[model samples]
Target: MPHLTIEYSPNLGDFPEADMALALNASVCASPEVKDESDLKTRFVRTRHFQIGTADTPRAFVHAQLRLLAGRSPKAKQDLSERIAAVLRRMAPRPDGTLVQLSVEIVDMDRPSYVKESLG
Candidate 1:
């Protein structure tokens, strides 16, 4: 299972969260580490209270977190992370006078404790 979460500043000015999620989902699906694209899920959360560097200047940031089942090699994770970072950098809003910071992180889910039950 791969879950992608995007946390970003609210002041970014009408960001297209839905489209961004779709693009990221595609990016995740492109990774060789992922088994299935249908299982990929992505969501975005806007943060209203946050400071970057100096409070006086208008600074923004987007942080992407990807969680997947454990057992992938370090190279696989790094590849996925780099792909995601590229997508984020390309999609993130660049408001005229604001400095935006982009970052990506990959998290591993413990296979022993992780559980999933689907009902369809």
Candidate 2:
């Protein structure tokens, strides 16, 4: 299973969370390294209190943390990270004066320690 968490500064203004989730899910599923699209889970967290570069001016950032099962090669992970950043950057809102930064981090989970159960 792959879990993606998005954290952003609320000062960036209203964000289309649903659209972002859908777009990110599609991006994650596009990668061949991801085994199942159904196993992907995504969520967004908005931060109200955050400082950027010690500046009082308005600055926005979108940070995505992706967690996947351990096994993928370093190159695969790097590619996935780049793809994710591209998708996010394309969708991120950039106001005339606000500086927006997009970033992604990929983390591997220990297969033995990771557990999942679904009942339908």
Candidate 3:
């Protein structure tokens, strides 16, 4: 199972979080790193109070943390992250002079410690 958590600054007004999630899921589904698309879990968390650089300068950021069970190759991980970043760049528009930053972080979870039981 791969759980994707998307965090972003609150300044991203009218952000296409849902659409971005769908696009991301589709991208991941096409990757060889994942077994199935249905196993993906995604959510977005908006940062209400935060600052980057000068207080007056307009800045916004979207960070995606993807957690997966250990055992994937380093190349696969990098590919996934890069694919995600590309998607973010295409989906998340950068406002003029907003200094928007998009990043993706891949986290490897201990396979033995990770537990899950899907209910149908």
Candidate 4:
């Protein structure tokens, strides 16, 4: 776990982002590359107008982007993505009137570097 961006609809309410971050960190730590929890970084963004018309009322959608700074492997990325997705799915509310959607994308740091220092 290095950097994780969790984007969701503003309708999610004022939930505990910190708790989510911690859970994500713990999940990543289960991986080999995530040797230290200190190396993890996380961010949550709640935006409005992120609706799914196909779904019924009371909809909720969430997109998660996870960037790993170490131990970049295809298996690792797949595993992490699935794990994160599962976690988010369980944590997210149901689409009673709210259509709940969740997706997770994992990025490997070994290739295509995009760190702050590299950006310059």
Candidate 5:
């Protein structure tokens, strides 16, 4: 199972959360470890108030955390993270004069402790 959460600064203008989620889900599902695309879940959150250290310069950021059930090799995790980072970079908007930093982190969820339910 893959759970993704993308947090972005509010100043990032007309953020396309839905489109980003679609792209990210596709990227994650491409992995051999992922059994089905429907198993991937993503949600976006906007940070209403954030600060970039002491720098007053116009800066923004979009950070994504991808959580997966533990057991994958290190290389697999790294590659999966890299794929997501590339997708985030492509989707992130380069606003005029705004320093935007995009990043992704891969978190391993305890497989035994994780639970999911699919209901109709």
Candidate 6:
């Protein structure tokens, strides 16, 4: 099970937020290994501002975190991370030259209390 959470600056309007969520969810569900759509959950959070290094950039910065169940092999994790980053870059291209930080974390469901809830 993997839970994908996308947190971005509120500069992105409702339409962009909804579009990004759908794109990310589709990317994850498109994974060959993911059998059930219900197993994939995506949440989007829009913040007022996000500090990047010392300077606060006006451009919106998108950070994505994908938390997966523990049993997945290291190779799978790396592949998933690459796929997620690729999808984000394709979806959230920067108007400016600033970079979008995409982070991926794979958590073990056994050691942690990660639950697989419906994506309703």
User: What TM-score, computed on C-alpha atoms, does each candidate reach?
Assistant: 0.93, 0.93, 0.93, 0.76, 0.94, 0.73
> Against the true structure, what is every candidate's RMSD?
1.2, 1.2, 1.3, 3.8, 1.1, 3.3
lDDT of 3 by residue, 1-120 (tens): 999998998887778988999998998878888888888888989987988877888899999999999899999999989878988899886778898988899999999878899777
lDDT of 5 at 50: 96
Q: Highest TM-score: which candidate? A: 5
User: Could you tell me which residue pairs clash in candidate 1?
Assistant: none
The alpha-carbon deviation from the true structure for residue 73 of candidate 4, after best TM-score superposition, in angstroms, is 2.4
lDDT of 4 by residue, 49-116 (tens): 76577646676778999876655668777888887887787676564455667888877666445444
**Backbone clash numbers for all candidates listed:** 0, 0, 0, 8, 0, 1
- The global C-alpha lDDT for each of the candidates, from Candidate 1 onward, is 0.88, 0.88, 0.89, 0.75, 0.89, 0.69
lDDT of 6 by residue, 29-52 (tens): 887757787777788777765676
* lDDT at position 88, candidate 3: 89
Q: What's the residue-level lDDT of 101 in candidate 6?
A: 64
Candidate 6 vs. truth: CA RMSD? 3.3
Model 5 lDDT-worst window of ten: 111-120
- Candidate 3: Cα lDDT at 46: 90
**Candidate 6 global TM-score:** 0.73
Error of 4 at 18 (Å): 2.3
- Residue 93 Cα positional deviation in candidate 6, in Å, after optimal superposition: 4.4
Better candidate by lDDT, 1 or 4: 1
